[model samples]
Target: MQRQTLRLLSSTASIVFSVLATQASAQMFNSVQLHAAAPGQSGGMLGVAALSTPEYQGSAKNRKLIVPVVDYQWANGWFAGGSNGLGYNFSGDPKFHYGVRMTGDIGRKEKRAKLLRGLGDIDAKPEIGAFFTFNPGADTYFASSVRYGAGNDNKGMLFDLSAGFTESWNRNLSAGASLGASYANDNYMQSFFGISQVQSARSSHKIYTPKAGLKNTYVSAFVSYMINDRTSLSLIVTSDRLAGDAKSSPLSEKTRTSSIVAAAAYHF
Candidate 1:
């Protein structure tokens, strides 16, 4: 019983440690990494996260949000909660993971800033994607994913690639860093960064059209600490720089964005 309990608690901490980052990163931790609880045991992390993120992918404006966290996965490799979205893991490899899921983005809203006054709202759209991840060692991992059906007409697409490493300083602490980039389709680029003729006439910005290319590159670092058997704390910082056509959008006031996240999670 004690062994199972420890496993359950450890599983909770593992999930908590990666939750917020995965929420913002559009990646999913493998089942072996996430569902570590003992057979028939239930230990999922739930908490709150505070974030300061760009209004849009390349927006210079930042917005703050506080949201609740909820996640629990069963033994069958199916789970749903918060930002990781609903998904199922079919891979049984301890070092490799692959799956399909539904993910989406909150499209830009004109009310987000005066700079967007002339640009109309880009309605949020649903996206479906497949993901693959490989853990070559206990401390290193590589992940990639492609999402489609984005944009107003569902013609946009996104591809994400990242690599990372984590070091466990002690039973109670772990730290890691990641480097990644995002690629977008022409439709996706235009949907968010392109300015239409009507928009140019209505807003202060001039008409501009963007092409599909690498949208941004980012670096992230994070540290997590277990406060107790059932609780954990984490802090993550990320900085993103717009690249290719994404950097030259006339609608963009800044080509770089940095964000911070802090949270505490508990297993119940």
Candidate 2:
């Protein structure tokens, strides 16, 4: 269980924005997820965390949030909670997992900041997707996932890919780092980065339409300390840079930014 606890730290070391997802669209996450726990060794976590993020994806503003942290898995491979969403673990191999999941997007709201005056609200949407993860060694992991059903028409799609490495300095101190990328489809790009003519007329910016392509690249690192078997404390830092369409879009204010997060989690 101590080893499993450290794995969780590697999985979330790079989240800079929200308590739930790594990326803004469809609640995308780092390559490693909450599904890699040893099978039948089911356990759960309950905690709270604070998030510091840009007012929107590209705005030059920031906002803070207090979010709940909850995650759990059953002995039968069924899991639910923050990054895991509600998914089933089907991989027969103990070193990896592949399954389907239901996740959601916390769409952007224009009213969140003054910079978004003309842009309309983007309604949150439920999503369906697949996840695949592989651990080549006890300390190395590769992960990828794709989700659909975001945006106003619910036709947006996003693909996230990542890899991670972990280490244990001692029985009570652990650390990990990860690298990842994100891709957006036409609908998803247009909804968030592109502005229509009608929208241009209403907003401060001109009409700009961006095609689908690579959206961002990021890296994350973390250090965690175990207070005891059931409790742990962590400090996570993540940095991301916009690329391709997301970078060229007029909506992008700061192309590169970083996030810092601290949390305490308990295992049961």
Candidate 3:
């Protein structure tokens, strides 16, 4: 009887060992898997195709164009003292995201008449007036202004309103859009549309009028990427649409216009 019991115990022990071995093999086959995360997670292979350019482009025709002398700003509250220009700011806080600016330009004596005549010569004296701007944030800005010129043929007032926005997605990439409109006396209106030969002749003025009339609209977009901490590149494009009396004028080209610019900036 004792011999029979020993045999049964040995058999049971062998069965238990086999079952344990099978489970160990199964666990090895079902090992945990590891995979790579998406590109943005590692700052590699970001899929933004547009930002992959080796060089930068923007609205200034890839040329290092400084902000025009006519639009330079002064102290945080006011911009003044550049060629008969004055500006005041009603709102000064950038963080709270609201402010207003008023700017004015006075007439100047040296009206490049010879150059002005080459375009569509309105031959007007310098103008003076104030513009009001409302900035809600770094992303959005709006403005309206009026000016009066002294020229016998050119003396008239202009009213203009414009708004624009900029957006950034990451530390190195950004985009922007803008729109604007304006109304003014016939001479000022013509000059705005690029039809007034006079304004175009003054390459220094860099002004254009819509052929359609005194009313004009413009739109623009731009994208920028920072290659590094000090160097960056950008691309910009813009379009203008004309309407009203200017469209019927001899200078009216009554068509959509566009421009592309690439630029690189070094931050000091």
Best by lDDT: 2
Question: Of models 1 and 2, which has the larger TM-score?
Answer: 2
lDDT of 2 by residue, 165-214 (tens): 87988877888877888899999999888898988999989888888899
What is every candidate's alpha-carbon RMSD to the true fold? Answer: 3.8, 2.3, 27.1
Question: Each model's TM-score, in the order given?
Answer: 0.85, 0.92, 0.50
lDDT of 1 by residue, 80-190 (tens): 655345676676664776788776665667887777897888887777877887877656778787888767678888888878777676677777777788888999888
Question: What's model 2's lDDT at 101?
Answer: 88
For model 2, the stretches where C-alpha displacement exceeds 4 angstroms are 1-5, 8-27, 30-32, 35-37
TM-score of 3: 0.50
The deviation in Å at residue 181 for candidate 1 is: 0.5
Across residues 1-268, which tens digit of lDDT does each residue of candidate 3 receive? 2222222221111121112111111000000000011111211011111211101111111122222111123334443322213434444443221222222222222232223334433332555565455555434566565656622355555566666555666666666666666565755444433433454454444445433234556676767666664345556555555446544433433334444444444322
Ranking by TM-score: 2, 1, 3
Which regions of candidate 1 are displaced past 4 Å? 1-43
What are the lDDT figures for the candidates, one per model? 0.67, 0.73, 0.37
Off by over 4 Å in 3: 1-76, 80-86, 95-125, 150-154, 190-214, 227-232, 266-268
Candidate 1 lDDT (Cα, 0 to 1) = 0.67
Per-residue error (Å), model 2, residue 135: 1.3
